[model samples]
Target: MIYAIGAVVGLIGGIKVYNKFSSGDPDTSKTAASWFGACIFLIVAATILRSFFL
Candidate 1:
């Protein structure tokens, strides 16, 4: 359940990040990259934890 929650959060976060980047100036590339990375990391971490424990 925790892992699923993490994935859902990540998915929603990633979509928001994408929208932010799309509607803003290109000068914020670094900020967008970090946010996108964080979303990916959350999903990956959740997958790893779930696989290890369940």
Candidate 2:
């Protein structure tokens, strides 16, 4: 379930990044980094929580 959510978030982030890139947005790198960070945070948080609970 956690991974599924992550995948969905990643897909959304990918599309947003791709759109920014195609439109030549100057802040695209920052946006991409933030999105990537969010996804990684989610995965790490889930792992930590699962370890604590199970």
Candidate 3:
């Protein structure tokens, strides 16, 4: 559940980063990268948690 929340937060952050970069607002490449990392981490964690719990 915590991992899922992390993923959702990461998704929202990534979307914000994408929108900024694509709209000529700012680069935000680092933020996007961090968000990507967070998303991947959460996904893996969630998968592992599920495997262990269910």
TM-score (all chains, Cα) for each model: 0.55, 0.96, 0.59
- Candidate 2 residue runs with Cα over 4 Å from true position: none
* Alpha-carbon lDDT, every model: 0.71, 0.96, 0.82
In candidate 3 the C-alpha lDDT for residue 30 amounts to: 78
Worst 10 residues of 3 by lDDT: 24-33
Pairs in clash, predicted candidate 1: none
State which candidate, 1 or 3, has the greater lDDT.
3
Compared with the true structure, the alpha-carbon lDDT of candidate 2 equals 0.96
lDDT of 1 by residue, 1-54 (tens): 665766676777677667777888564667656767876777788789878988
User: Ranking under lDDT, best-scoring first?
Assistant: 2, 3, 1
Write one digit per residue (lDDT tens) for candidate 3, span 12-53. Answer: 997799788888775688778788888888888888988998
Looking at model 3, the pairs that clash are none
Which of candidates 2 and 3 is the stronger one according to TM-score?
Answer: 2
The reply for model 3, stretches above 4 Å from the true place, is: 1-7, 19-27
For residue 29, give model 1's deviation from the true position in Å.
Answer: 0.4
